[model samples]
Target: MTTFPQHSRNFLFTVLALVLPVLLGAATILAKTLTVSPTGKIRSVKEAVRLAQPYDTIWVNAGIYHENEITIDKPLAIIGRQQAVLDARFKKGIFSVMAENVLIAGLTLQNVEESFTKNYAAVRVRGGGHVTVRNNTILNSYYGVYLEQTDSCTVSHNLIRGNAKQESTSGNAIHLWRTDHINIVSNKVSGHRDGIYLETSSNSTITGNISQNNLRYGLHFMFSDNNSYQRNQFMRNGSGIAVMYSRNIIMTDNLFEENWGAAAYGILLKDITDGYIERNIFRQNTTGIYAEGSSRLLLKNNEFRNNGWAVRLLGSSEDLTFEQNNFIGNTFEISTSTNYSSHNTFRANYWSSYTGYDLDKDGTGDVPHKPVKLFSYLLEDIPTSVVLLRSLFIDLLELMEKVAPVLTPENVLDNEPSTRLNVWKS
Candidate 1:
């Protein structure tokens, strides 16, 4: 062979050195996937986990694995193929992931035993970043998924249901405690104590969830701040949703429907501040939005339809504004203990009960529309007085109150009521 130049030999050696590690790294990334099946070499998932390198995939086939508890301490992707079952033997959680960047996907975890203590979940992320628990089916479990003290995790595309009857014994379906920046999206939860419970968690986004038919509030958040829930549905729960002692919350494009009970409401805003409730539909609720000691809320473009008391402002609430909303077919549009002071302002809403005329050819009415009738306040004190709602005497009393307001709040006025209906295409 002809002798090569010094620079050419140096360049070849450099290229070989750079390309060697790349080939090894590619082989590591494309590492062997361990098959966990009855007939496979690795029969148990726990043994596969012990033998697997970090970032390797453990493909579990369709079979039942009696795993009372599983701890994923390494960054492994444990994916189930075709509904592989992880029966927890009526014990505690099925999987407790304690590693960073772990993924558990497409599994069926079921039959967790009920416990008075130790909230048992199907899957729990204790402390990790970039942990994703997705596309799993959890049935008859105590707690569906729990994220405690975890950060930047995702819990998405999971179907969770529990037949929990007692509140003192059952736990939440998806419970987040002290977890921050968690993205809980596109999950369906039902028949649990609370569908989703957030306590002292912050900077989280819960979007596109359908929570219904739970024993308690469909979604409850307490002492959680800077969180946003959008495009979610909360229907037919014990007390629909309770947001307590939270600040800087945004609730948009949500459906709160058919939450009818003695204490049920579409949403209970208690002691919250600096929040925005926009473009939401509150229909067929006992009370659409009950405000208690809440302040500085911007409620806009929302529709309250056929509710008992559309908005009940408690005596301690202040500085709440209702604007650009449609309040239609509500039994009591606004009810307050004492309307002597204008703690809340109402402006630019379309009320079907408004009898004002637009004489100036403008879209808005010339006179302000008062939503609170005398009957509204009457039903507040005596809820059983609705039997005489359609009688002529009740009509006469409402007409007289509309002509000259005495008992209703004079300050809670929609200054520019729309003469036409504010029909939204939501």
Candidate 2:
């Protein structure tokens, strides 16, 4: 046995302590790249994932790989070259990710059959953080990209399409449950039950997504709070967008169009409090907005055009402020429930139906605008009376009621109505 002096041993230990971290960092920086190809030694992605270390790169080449339920338990980047397709073969899910900082990009995952007892997704991040699933195409899956108990994850720039006939058999295109700080950006989701469904999720941002032609809602939020939804398009869905049981939300710069059904609206706000619905365009819907049991919501700079009812305020909703909105060519500019004695305030909104003049040359009309028509108030109890719309007797009844101030909710008047349409650049 060779023994060194005490000073020499201490110097060697100090040198090793300095060199070891650099060597380990170099090893981490030089993470190995595993290849998955048709004729390669590592042909399967599951094999690649099994043989990969943390922060390794798995490059899948172009081919149709028949694989399912591929679990990734380590942080890895799975990148596809050319058009790599992972066919689930109508079996289980494609990728079940359980690791943080995982990236799955530029791949096609398809054919995850519907299951009654399970939710199979094309890419599912369970109990993970900072996972990203981007630039992929998900087709015919039960769920496109599912985040369960995930935080700080992103599902962006993906095209998720499903052939959903009924709501019972179909799932959402992008579903988030109990997630926080999620970024769902620039994705196009259609033909699913709901395009994007958030339940019990909070502090998330959903922007620049086009959610159209879904079976149920374009975007559905249930019990989700403190989220931001901006610059999205919700068009031609069965029920449009439904934000329910949530608080402190911000919805701005969205386009809601052509959601025509007897029960459909541009948005249905139920039990929501302390939110902002600003700079949105609601066009050609059955109703632009239907608020029930919502409070303290600021509806500002929104345009409601050519709708059956531009705004339907139920009696249960209170303290909603509608300001600087443009209500143009709607059959009924506003509707309220029978007992509509709420503290809803409407100010500075431009109503095309308003005939009041501004004699003082100010932008605001001198006469206040009463948006709720008598026929609209009557149709709240007798919905079948909508067939009598545009009739002479109904017009006369509305004019008389406007002069006398009868059944329409008096509190839902715009004292400072805008003389011209408000142009918002949001």
* TM-score of every prediction relative to native: 0.91, 0.94
- lDDT (C-alpha) at residue 227 in model 1: 98
Best by lDDT: 2
**Model 1 clashes, total count:** 0
Task: Name model 2 segments beyond 4 Å from true.
Answer: 1-27
lDDT of 1 by residue, 32-52 (tens): 789999778888888888899
Instruction: Give the per-residue lDDT digits (tens) of candidate 2, residues 1-426.
Output: 999999999999999999999998997788999999998999999999999999999999999999999999999999988789999988989999999999999999999979888999999889979999999999988899999998999999999999999999999999999999999999999999999999999999999999999999999999999999999999999988898999999999999999989788899999999999999999999999999999999999999999999999899999999999999999999999988788988989999999999998789999999888899889999989978978999999988997898677777889999999898776
| Candidate 1 segments whose C-alpha is farther than 4 A from its true place | 1-31, 339-342, 423-426
Weakest lDDT window of 10 consecutive positions for candidate 2: 402-411
Relative to the unseen true structure, what is the C-alpha lDDT of residue 263 in candidate 1, on a scale of 0 to 100? 97
Please, what is the whole-model Cα lDDT of each candidate in the order they appear?
0.89, 0.94
